[model samples]
Target: MSRRVVVTGLGGICATGANVPEFWDNSKKAVCGVSVRTLKAGDEYSITLPIAPIDGFEDRLAEFGRDMARADRFTQLAIAAADEAVRDAGVDFASGLGRRTAAIVGTGIGGQTTFDAAYLAMLKHGRKPHPLSILKIIPNAPASHMSIRYGLNGPAFAISSACASGAHAIGVAADMIRSGAADAALAGASEALLTYGAMETWKAMHIMSDELCRPFSKNRKGLIIGEGAGVLVLEDFAAAKKRGAKIYAELAGFGMNADGKDMINPAVEGAAGAMKTALSTVGAFDPAGVYINAHGTGTLLNDPTESKAIRDVFAAGADSLVVSSTKSMHGHLLGAAGAIEAIATLKAMETGVVPPTINYDEPDPACDLDYCPNEAREQRIDLALSNSFAFGGLNAVLAFRRV
Candidate 1:
């Protein structure tokens, strides 16, 4: 028999919240986490920009133990979130499940903070870099850490597709379970690129917002970078049911495609095709009961192009469904954007409250849709879609249904 995958647990940490419940609560309140901050390197190089960064998280780092203490910020964040997921799922790895669990974590730019510190020490301070710098800076650090941390012995690796990394990791893990490669998996993504050097590079692109991220708005500037991690515990539906686990939602469908057009510019056809392909696995659905967690980066080109894609996929029903960008509250997490957004989508389905797209002062006709606006809205949501469109024209859409 063909297997089905279900989300048995969800965990997330971001600027808006330190964990899933907190994140969802802050999101529902439309609390904006974006603020002006200054980052410096070697006292000479510094950049001031609006960023959504977590504060007071350092106090909790020691609780993760020595290995995590020595790991990069990105991997540490992943462990923080994954710990919560495993606890929530009530999974005992000691009971033979560890041998069948896969750990698939993704990151767009891994260990940016560590890399910056190492480079600063070696180049600017005329000192040797950390001996374990390579291990911490590797993109697979999170995946490897999770495997050792949780005793997972199945397929473990990292996927780096820029912003789509999270969704791609989750999708691939689900496929693995469905194909009988694994019985359970820890999947998601983490990103910690809020360093001085990283911010300077992003600033050089001139695509970052000066103030707030206002997606689908006429006065939108651009995306504000944030750092954190989100993770999910996925298990074969039958096993989850047999174990009496509290299922959050069903991993119904996943779609991924590349634009093959531009490195920066998003393609409308690519976005629409991905959504359509995801829906193909969904069979059919009521448009009014759908909620889309948009990949609304609040950028000039992405907003309208994604709007058109939604219109293309849903056609007349596009106007009926509600869509919102929680990035307006939590800021863009780059690779981990899809993972936390998927958590947001699942929360919306669970609570029937669609989080708002905050900072929307003006609406653009080109990007016309029910964005929920600055206030959360109560609606019956039977289906949810989390969209992740990355640089290099990579797009991933995940569809979930109430289980």
Candidate 2:
């Protein structure tokens, strides 16, 4: 028999804040976190870009009892977020519950900091890399660290599907619980690729915006890179209620599909299909009441394509649905984007205020919808959808209903 899954706790750190409450508060106010930072590329060239980075995160490593020099930035961020989530959930890991718990994290480019440091040392400084570099640089290090810290013995692994990684991780964790493979799971994603090398590489892609992100706006430029982590404590619904856990929201359904048509370009059919599958899993609801946490990267193509997909799926009801992109404030956290955005969605459900998509200059005719722009609106949302469309045409959508 299948089981139901619910989000018990949320933890996240981003440019806007170092925890979920702070992130949500700053996001609702449409406070922009993108800023210009200058960093040494390779002792020769310095690069500056509008990027969102967490400040003073290094000091947080001491709380986890981890060696700051050994742990990769990504892993540190994940551990911090996971610790906050586990504490928020008030789960007793020592009560043999660890055996039935799992840890699943996602990252697009894991250990980029380690790789960049190793290469710079070897190529420029003629120094050999640290012996533990391999362990720290691997993509699964975050999951491993989280499992070890929390004593999780059940299924533990990592997903690396670019931007969709976080949403995919949560979906897979929910499936594991529903399938009775695990009773609870720590699921989320983390990314810390703001190093000089990583930024230089992204600059070559020519998609970095010089100004702030403005999704669904006619004057939108492109996406800004951000760094942080977002994690949720997912538990079986019945078990959570029995234990008197404070349930945040029900993770009702998940849907994903691949375009299989292009590497970077998005297809409306694929996007619409994913949304339809998610909604169908939980039966249909009034489309007008659903709020969408859009995968709005403020790019030239994503906004219009996503708007078209919403119209395709919801038809006339799409005109009443509210859609907003928190990325306009937090910047795109890459693999961590969906996880943080999911937290934003849940917080919206709890608070009855929909966060706005900031920096909206002018509306595009192709992207006409009720995008809560510039200011937070007072609206109670019972059901919400968080969309994550990755660069490789991979799309993942998650459905959440207020409990």
Candidate 3:
């Protein structure tokens, strides 16, 4: 039989809250994180837009030995989330686990802020790049920092697939245990792309919301950029049981696929294929048993595309399924979106309360589905799926089951 993998602990830091409880409290109330916009450091924006800010991130960074100057915003978020996840998993850090434990994190754009600063320095100061420039801005910096912090000697690297990066990271790490590559793994994603250069890139694409984020609204605008990190501690079920570790939920299945079509446009068949693969792997093919955490970036293209994808996979079953975009509450955390939503799904199972999608005043007819709009619900959920679609036509789906 294939080895079973499960989530032992969860940690997340975002605009909603820095810790799990605070994050949940904000989510449960359907609070909106999108706020007034401002200019990013080293960016020259003729216009500023509202964005969700994560306050006190620097305070969290002080616990580790990483120099603030040597780290990127994405790495900072990763350290915070990974530290909490490791502690929550009841990991004996001093034990040999770090040597055996794997660290896999992801980021859509690594160190855009650092790149922005260094380039400006070249023009203004006419000086050489900073010593840590290479370290701070790479996408893999999060993985390296996490491994160094806890002495994890196992495989460590960052996966980049745009917004789908988090789900891909967690899914691949779970496969590590399934294939005997590692005993335990820390899998997640973090992103801090509020820099002027980052903003300019997205602004050029014309995807920022002028006011608020409305996921399924008929008049929905574009995505609101936000920042945060989320990490999960995964281990083999047999090993966790032997160690007397509590299993939050089984990491039942994962599905990954590429559209092979347009790099930026969503593909209906690609998204549905991943969902079907996940259901089959987890033996949760019975659609009634699953709740979906929709990608729901509040962008017009994403919301509708996701709705059709869900319908295409489950067909009639999609009608009865429970789906919500907690992104409505937390805003979009770019690459961290999937991991944090997975954590939210696990928390919903633990507490029997599915968070609501707030600011749902206007609904799009074309994007119709059971979004659990505007209110939290008490329901017994057995299996749940979190879907993430990213740039470059990458898609990932994860399955979690009540233990």
Best by lDDT: 1
Name model 1 segments beyond 4 Å from true: none
Clashes of 3: 3
Local accuracy of candidate 3 as per-residue lDDT tens digits, 187-227: 99998888777787787887778887778878778788888
The whole-model C-alpha lDDT of candidate 3 against the native structure comes to 0.85
Candidate that would win on TM-score: 1
Structural similarity to truth (TM-score) of each candidate: 0.99, 0.98, 0.96
**TM-score (C-alpha) between model 1 and the true structure:** 0.99
Residue by residue across 117-222, what tens digits does model 1's lDDT show?
9999989899999999999999999999999998999999999999999999999999999999999999999999999999988988989999999999999999
Model 2 weakest 10-residue run by lDDT: 60-69
**Model 2: clashing residue pairs?**
none
CA lDDT of each candidate?
Answer: 0.94, 0.90, 0.85
RMSD (Cα, Å) of model 1: 0.7
Show how many residue pairs clash in every candidate, following the order shown.
Answer: 0, 0, 3
The ten-residue window of minimal lDDT in model 1 covers 276-285
